[model samples]
Target: MISKWNYLPLSPEQDAIKKKLVRELSLSPVLCELLVQRGVTSITEAKKFFHPQLSDLHDPFIMNDMDKAVERLDRAMGGKEKILIYGDYDVDGTTAVALVYKFLRNFYSNIDYYIPDRYDEGYGISKKSIDFASENDFKLIIALDCGIKAIEKVAYAKSKGIDFIICDHHMPDEDLPDAVAVLDPKRTDSAYPYSHLSGCGVGFKFMQGFAINNDIEIKKYLYPLLDLMAVSIASDIVPITGENRILAYHGLKQLNTCPSLGLQSIIHLCGLKNRELTISDIVFKIGPRINASGRMQSGKEAVDLLISKDMEGAKAKSENINQYNEDRKKLDSQITNQANEIILKNCKDLDKRKSIVIYNADWHKGIIGIVASRLTELYYKPAVVLTYSNGLVTGSARSVQGFDIYKAIEYCRDLLENFGGHTYAAGLSLKEENIPHFINRFESYVSENILPTQMSPQLDIDINIEFNEITPSFFRTLKMFNPFGPGNTNPIFCTKNVYDYGTSRLVGRELEHLKLEMVDSRSENIMNGIAFGMHEYNDHIKSHKPFDICYTLEENTHNGASNMQLMIKEIRPSE
Candidate 1:
């Protein structure tokens, strides 16, 4: 899986701006270049980027129909109407449901929550769940993370005398659902400044709006909910640029200092307690466990773990959820291996194919999405993992950096019974017979539209710098750019004319990692670097010749001492 390295070029004007920022902030030129590349040219922008504040969050009322949504909720609370917090079965949905349910419970007690079973009800506002709400005498249903596309289901609930207030962030269809209020910033008419909020972030905004309308301090209700928002933002893979950044910034603070009992139990269970957890910690460690509940079993258990107030109850639920996560890992690994084998054996000319579409009727639907993502990492192309269930071919799709997978799937809509997703990921179902045609059409669509560059992975190098710049002060300033994600990513710096000082070794249980004592050719500055899964480069580095490397700086603590280490991204022989 070789990738093209794209060394970003800086214009003279941009260089001049970086120089000015360097002079104004009294920072290193390399740090200034990194900031300039991220669109932080001015000191004001740098201040906001480096020091994100909760006060910087936008007003929740800026979202369209926020007032209506809040008013409907207030009415429901005043009338003691049975309000149900409805959400999807994933982490974003479960966390959103938990956040809203717990917050509303603080003020009103006539509230319960519902998470549709992934295997039974599928995704989003289902007809069966609506019928349950109708039969249970529930009058108000606040759908979180979903319902933006549930026009028919919302209408059905409406006919049953149930009103809906939807809080979703997905791209909505033109014909909006006839709910009492739609609280999606992605709504074409929405005025909210930040539109890339996670589902839980949108739900938190509703709570913010409710607090404002009630003349109560918003922080009293909002601060406690930041942990949930952080988990959703990280897990949902939303852009962490605007409000999402603020929420994640503060939410991580809450998670480290005083997490909820459920979160605390999960942290303890994962052995991540007494440490500052990062977005990656939540995304890889915490988020997966939370999502595993929904994927392997009932998502209600996840919501239960999230909203539980007692330590004992949360611990009990955490143990169960942890086991589910363990089970999910086993299945995920087994399915990924099976999918890889299928691709290797079936696809003769893997390079000629623009997309990957593999189907196994016996494949578990719960792990298809994970397997699709895994396949993309190895194949470096759009992948669709399908399984036959209930006489239909159902599956998940994952795309590369610049590809629009949902649009590609939409091109084959005639063959697909239903499909929905954004640019990089989607889900679809079709008849068994249409599987071959859908695969051909989808492959043809991708081959015709996708660019040559889009077919292969590309690493975007932020800047080229010398090892002299890797100082304690420089690393400290870089640490200000915390909570990195899709929109704002960690800076990848390329250092030219670098070589291992006769101390490079392959380290790791499988001897698959390259540990190097890298030295700068110009400054003779030394830095320890580790390239995980790059043992193939051991001979290249041990040659003692100058080479170029791209990497990110990370603080590695060992034996009670902390020092900066380069986490190598790519290595190349110097030209």
Candidate 2:
């Protein structure tokens, strides 16, 4: 893998532009400079950065069927009608189910939820789900994380006199189904200002309006549930700014102080020793365990854990979730190794192909997307991983920045039987025979559109400074950019001259990491570093050449000993 290390390279034109913004805004040079760095060069743009508000959210009634959907839900709650929620089996889907499930459970005792079995039902709303909704006497049905593509199933449910309200964020086709209300910002008719909400966020917003119309206390009832929305936002890789940023910020605050019983148990299980839990903790230490349930079997168990009221129920579910996570780790490693071997041997046109569309009839459909995501990161290209079982072909696609993988698939829609997803990720199905044509045409579309320069990942450097700038206060100041994710990123600082001047050791049994010390008495500060997943380049680093290092400062603690350390991201021989 080619590691990227970016330093803020300045030009005369850029400096002049920065000076102009600094003069016009009457803002601190630091704030103005940062905004200029972000491509905002005037006070009009600066107002947006300095003042963030909830009024920025789009009008709730502007979505295609928002009024009708909210009206149907209001009726269900008022009449004590049995309400059933259906969702798919991923982190986003499960979290969406939890949000809607808990929100409705607050108002009515007749609320219940269902998540499809990954192996048995595959993806999206199924005929079985509609059948169950009708038979159970749930006059009102809410579909989360899916159902935008279920044309036939929605019609089937409508025929049974059940009202369907869809809360999905995927790209929509020209023809919508016959649901009572379809809520997707991706639709052409939607006037929602921000089109990038996680599935759970959409469900939460639906509840936000429902609470307002019903004259319920929204903060007391809804805000505490944001922890689930936060997890879904990170797990689904949604941009974490605007409404999402506010939701995640409040969600972390809630988890740190007062959390749901299920979340509190999982928090203790994950070993988050600090009371200050950020988005990183949720993604790295926790989200995978909740997701492991759906990936291996049924996501219904996860929803059970989220809504479990009794302490014993929460404990048992947490223990099972932890074990599932362990199993996921083992299976993921095996699939990654096996898939890599197959690609190296059989993918002859890899260099020439635009998007990777690989399928194996014998491969496990449950793990193909995970393996496919690994492939995209390795090659820096759009990737599609597919598997076949019972005469049906199901596949998942992941994309790099600046390329819309969903749009690429739309170019070949005629060849597909069913599909739904957003800009960077999507899921689709087809006849087993269409694989070859898909591979050819999809690659042709990518090759024609993606420029060679654009194929390289965009490297963003927050700000650059020498090792002399290292301090506890400097780390403290960087907290202004907290709650980082797709929209906000951790600051990457660069120091040009550093000498390893010691043996570089590869750590871990698989040589998964590198550890080394760089001393520079020639400069004002001294430092130690650990570069994760960089053992592949140890031989080149052992030679005596000064290196440029990019890293984030982190505090290390062990046995009451505490000091600053470097979480080295990348290293390059000095230019």
Candidate 3:
């Protein structure tokens, strides 16, 4: 993909963070500057980031419908009612199902899990699920990572005497679902301070409230559930700030040592044990396999594996998920290549439009969002990639940092049949014929609202530290900002004129990474480095000279050895 090279600098705002850090933390200029650059100007903020805990979490009832949801959950556990945990088919939904199924199963054996099929039932709560629950005498249904827009399904469940509770984070419409308790932070009436909880986070919170109310030792129950929340948080691309930071923070901590059966199967397959896993691991490695089970086959498979009890069962489930991921990878690559070709041939008039919307009768709906991501990478604009068959159109939209895709789609209300997503990601459906008008209208809407400055990718560097100032001790203090993601990101700094000592070929399929050695700019000490997706730039980078680049400090481990290394983000070849 041809990504946009435009970037937002980190100098001006960073200077202010430094000043604030000096006054607030009462520290030396260098340390204070680092804190400020990381959006931690106050001493309190720094303390919290370093030591995130359960106390930093928001009150679960603050989310709209928490009380009602809790009431229904209490009733289910109280009466030993047969409960079905319903969820979507992706990583977020699968993790949610696992989190709820395991938590609830501890108190009630009548608990079972269900994930709707992507092709069969589409997204969210379904009539088929309600019918299944009814047939099995399941009285309580808790919908996770989905059900925010399931008004008809919720009503149908209620009529059948099946009380419903929703633990979701998707944006909701004007009319809320009539479920007995609808827990969603994105609801307009929601007073939850942070609205970016992933589906599992809401599910976790619902369980958290129940655990606290019952005096079940929230940490004992909740801590074990962090790995699930971490997977969802990373997979869904939510901001890792406030409550989310704490969730990802502790989730990652336990993720290293205490993966659940399903997660352990997946982690063992990835050869990760007693290792510090980052958000990128789940994003690129683990999340894909879990999501693949839903996209390529049945979402329920991933859920089954997640809630699997024994190693044998978990391994069997993981093999299925692995197979699906392998199939998905082939399909995704083929479609992405074709979509890129489609854009190159047909999107000549793209620069004039504010958005990119493409539809191919043959495009696979399973990977349209991946295509949308590819389109955004190539075009630097909000994009919607769709597949049309018969009269129905389903598509995925990926937005730039400045564009709120769901809100932008709201402007084209007349053309869409159904639409829902977060600020930067969304999914929608409409008739094939209405697409052109929706495309044209959505373009106009974006052009009117988005600013030129907002089009550039913002790189928020936490601090500017020379290579000499970096020491082994700083890594420990830096990890105080543990569990980095959207809000609490691993620090990136600018280093100028680092010495280059060539590189060794990092052998991997498709040349996924590169390894090199360089001399520290300030100390004249040698340092090891690795850069991802940099093989194509190898010639430009290693063209017989030293280079200045932007990178981040990272810990690299291999063969029972640990060492700090620099992960280069970008490089400028000498002119």
Candidate 3 residue lDDT tens string, 135-207: 9999998899888888888889889999888888888889988888888888888798988889999999898
Give the lDDT of residue 564 in candidate 2. 77
User: lDDT tens digits, residues 122-170, model 2?
Assistant: 7888877778888899898789988887888888888998888989988
Model 2 residue 540 distance off true place after TM-score fit, in angstroms: 7.9
- What is the alpha-carbon lDDT of model 1 when measured against the actual structure? 0.89
- lDDT over C-alpha atoms for residue 72 of model 3: 76
Q: Please report, in order, the local distance difference test score of every candidate based on alpha carbons.
A: 0.89, 0.78, 0.80
lDDT at residue 379 of model 1 (Cα atoms): 74
Q: Which residue pairs of candidate 3 clash?
A: 17-36, 37-462, 50-480
Candidate 2 deviant stretches above 4 angstroms: 4-32, 38-59, 273-275, 454-458, 500-523, 533-545, 557-563
Weakest 10 consecutive residues, lDDT, candidate 2? 48-57
Question: What stretches of model 1 exceed 4 Å from their correct place?
Answer: none
How close to the true structure is residue 557 of candidate 1, measured as C-alpha lDDT? 77
TM-score of 2: 0.90
Which one is best on lDDT?
Answer: 1
Rank the candidate models, highest lDDT first: 1, 3, 2
Candidates 1 and 3 compared by lDDT, better number: 1
Off by over 4 Å in 3: 1-31, 389-391, 453-460, 501-516, 519-523, 531-546, 573-575
